[model samples]
Target chain A: MAEMVFQRTKGLQDRPFHYCPGCTHGIIHRLVAEVLEELGVLDKAIGVAPVGCSVFAYDYFNCDMQEAAHGRAPAVATGIKRVHPDKVVFTYQGDGDLASIGTAEIVHAAMRGEKITTIFVNNAIYGMTGGQMAPTTLVGQKATTSPFGRDKNHAGSPIRMSEMLATLEGPAYIERVTVTTPAHIRKAKKAIRKAFEAQIEGKGFTMIEVLSTCPTNWGMSPVEALRWLEENMIPYYPLGVYKASEEVK
Target chain B: MAKVLMKGNEAIGAAAIKAGCKFFFGYPITPQSELPEYMAREMPKAGATFLQAESEVAAINMVYGAAGAGARVMTSSSSPGISLKQEGISYIAGAELPCVIVNIIRGGPGLGGIQPAQSDYFQATKGGGHGDYKMVVLAPASVQELTDLLMEGFDIADQYRNPVMIIGDGMLGQMMEPVELREPKKRNLPPKDWATTGTGGRGHTNVINSLFIDPAECEKHNLKLKAKFDEMEKNEKKYEIYNCDNPDIIVAAYGTTSRIVKTAIDKCKDEGINVGLIRPISLWPFPYEVFEEYADRAKAFLSVEMSLGQMVEDVKLGVNGKKPVYFYGRTGGMVPVPDDIVAEIKKILGGAK
Candidate 1:
């Protein structure tokens, strides 16, 4: 008999991901699931799925789930959290869903210091809507909507959500992380764990901003997308904890 | 409970509490603001959650969330605010979630005014949100009826796994009347086994969603929804007949306008003019049967409304050309006086001869 060195996270359903080739959403999803199972809240967890690429996250997560309308996951999560305060409620959202159309919901959820966790996946472009420009899209990046390469004057610069949310008094912990390499994946998972831990401690709102890659949408090979994210995305969205409430610390 | 004098808006809140509703999410909108304010003050004492959402859109979504979690939840707004909530309402209807919505109607077409109006008849009875869906719209004419319908609204919503709307104009929301806060009749509600509470090691995960990627599956879902609506039509259609015997003309109205029509019917009686009233309690599964029954006996059907005649189309549909259907209305925050309704009734009667 061969001893197994690794196994799939029990938090995820026994099914293959439908993500595009080289898309890092699978990895991020696995990391979040692993953390939830490791935290031993898998049975007590309820996840809210957004309207973007991960809309079928309800099918992926092993625990109970809800699919929210575009950009309304935070509000949905808030409702579930309020109904069952002891239950672990979280929302999985993409950049276009969180930073653009749902900006008001996200900001107000943070402002209210809701006792919920949010895993915001920032690929810098809209993945599900056939690669439209997202609020977090880099200024010079090209998208179907911004055909002329994002114009700094016309479209504004990429928004740094972790930095913006850090300024609010509601959040207990806010961090920006990526999964470009083995070392980075470890750090990203740790950040996700910390965010959920802070939420479990009843500290306040906690969000982990995962800088992800959309290789097909970016018109790059998976390898090149990783390299591009490290070189360009990292410089703009620095990897570190933007805020950590004293109580959580 | 004995009858107590209560504002219509507060009575609605109290009625919700009596009906086992545990959650309320709403935004402040005129003529309906008191409902949320009352909830905010009283829900905490009842171990219920009350959240003032940032917007009507957010409020309705919050209601959606709670409803999906298997809680009896609600939200309230006026015409304009209800307009903003259409998207969430559509989503709730599509998802087959149970919740209640209260619309204290004010004038509209865009912030039209704060005064009472029935201009939202089409939006409410028809689909306001983009979808092939139906909400059981209850038109309550007085504070007591508003209270009674609101309590029953929750049961109706849960019974059908659909949103139930209780609509009243500003006058019904703002006025004070004696209401008995009776314990609602018990219902054998289905177990919320589909709710998105954590599975707790249940064999399978529960997902609350409305998206059907396959058109074939989507069509089947639509058919399923239509079946629910058909059931609602068969069982939930409600109306009241006031002096609806063989008469010169039949008056069709609902909500605040119906109260005025009643007064007009009384005044017309003094002049020896036999007038009848058909007050529709449920606006969506409208009282068409009543119209079909009296179409030949009544010389004409006069549809009086606070809007420029939205419900008249439904009246015509019910009458089916057997008798003429005439429309009389006052719009833009204007209320029709009983005397005016009486004059219109006489005019229609005189014209028939």
Candidate 2:
């Protein structure tokens, strides 16, 4: 008899993903799902899906979910977590949903030290909206909205969200990770697991900013997208533990 | 509890807590700030959660979250603040979530004044948010009525799986009146089986969402929502006919304006002028049946409001050209006096009395 070495996590539904070819969202979603299943909280978890590319995440997560309006997931999660403190609540958001239109919600959620986990997928471009320039869009990167290759003077430099959020006193854990290789995938999963564990332990806000790739929007092949993200995004984002409180450890 | 003198805003907080509301998310806005302050002080004692959100936009979204989680929740704001909440309200309505919203109306087109006004009548009754939806709007005439409406508002929302708006003027929110926080009569509320409460191994995931990518699916959802609204129009229309017994002239008013109209009707009675009032408590359903019933007997319909003739349109629609419709109003934070309403009533009567 052949032994099965790997299986899909029960935290995720069996539905096929709608993400574009070479998009890193699938890997990130799988990592989050695997962490939830490993943490043994799949049945008690509620995920808030954002209005960007992952708007359909509700159909992908096996647990109960809510689809929030544009830029309102943090506030929505805050509401859920405040009422059901024992339930595991997390928000999966994109760069435009988190760093741009929803800036105030994310900042204030951290300011309140809300006991919720956030999976911030920083793809540096808007995917669902047909590749518009995002707040995390790197300097000199071309987007449909920024046709002039993201002029530094006209559009501000990319926002380093994890580093910025780590400065706030509310967060117990904050990290920046990527999934460009098998080794990186394992590390990203570890970061996601730690964030969820911190949330379950009643720590303050925990967030893992996943530096992802959008191959279709970036006008690159999937392999080239990974190389581009490694050379461009990783240099600016710097994959590491930005902040981790002693209590979280 | 026995009847106690309470401020209108504080009474709302007490009534909501008594109604088993588990959460409140609000922002400080004039004429409605006291309610949030009261909740902030009282919610913890009742084992409920109260949060002062960064903005009205955030507060309403928070209400959406709690409501989707199958928790009774609410938010409150005045006119301008309510404007900020319209986006979230539209989403909540589209998603068919149960929550209560209180709007202590002040003057507005933009940042008008802190004084009481009925300018938001159209915004409340009409869809302020960008969507084809309806909210069961209750326009309470006094502090006691405000208390009563909120006590039952949560149940009304849950029963229909829709948002409920309790609207009052700044005067109604600030005035002190004797109110008994009565235990609401039991209602047959539908179970919140659709709430996103972690499934608990329920064999299927319950998603709280309003996004329908397919146009056909979206249309179907819209029709389903319309059916619920039609049910509300049929079953939830509430109004009080005062001195409407074979009246010579009829007056239509709601919320704080209705109280002034009532006083005007009494003054008209002293002069041997038979005047009647059709006070609509449910503003969205508009109590059109009462207007239709009184149209043949009443010579004219006077729509009294604090704004420049908003509800008059609804009155005209209800009267259906059978009786001449006239509007009397004060604007920009001005409250109408009984004498002014009386004068308008006499003017519309054409000195026949």
DockQ of each: 0.80, 0.85
Residue-wise C-alpha lDDT for candidate 1, range B156-219, written one tens digit per residue = 8999999999999889988999999765577778888899888786778888888999999999
lDDT of 2 by residue, A141-190 (tens): 99999998998899988898888988999999999999999999999999
Q: B1-353, model 2: which lDDT tens digit per residue?
A: 67899999999999999999989999998988899999999999999989999999899999988999999999999999999999999999999999999999998789999998989988988999998999999999988888888988898899999999999877888899999987667889989999988878698898999999999999999999999999999988889889988788999989888888888889998998889899989999888877887999889999988999999999999999888888999998998999998888888787544
Chain A TM-score of candidate 1 vs. true chain A: 0.99
Could you give candidate 1's fraction of true interface contacts?
0.69
Give the candidate number with the greatest DockQ.
2
**Candidate 1 chain A minimal-lDDT segment of 10 residues:** A75-84
TM for every model, in the order presented, reads 0.99, 0.98
Task: Please list all clashing residue pairs in model 1, or write none if there are none.
Answer: none
Query: Could you tell me the lDDT of residue B243 within candidate 1?
Result: 92
Could you give the C-alpha RMSD of every candidate to the true structure, in order shown? 0.9, 1.2
Q: What tens-digit string does per-residue lDDT give for candidate 1 at A142-220?
A: 9999998999999999999999999999999999999999999999999999999999989999999999999999999
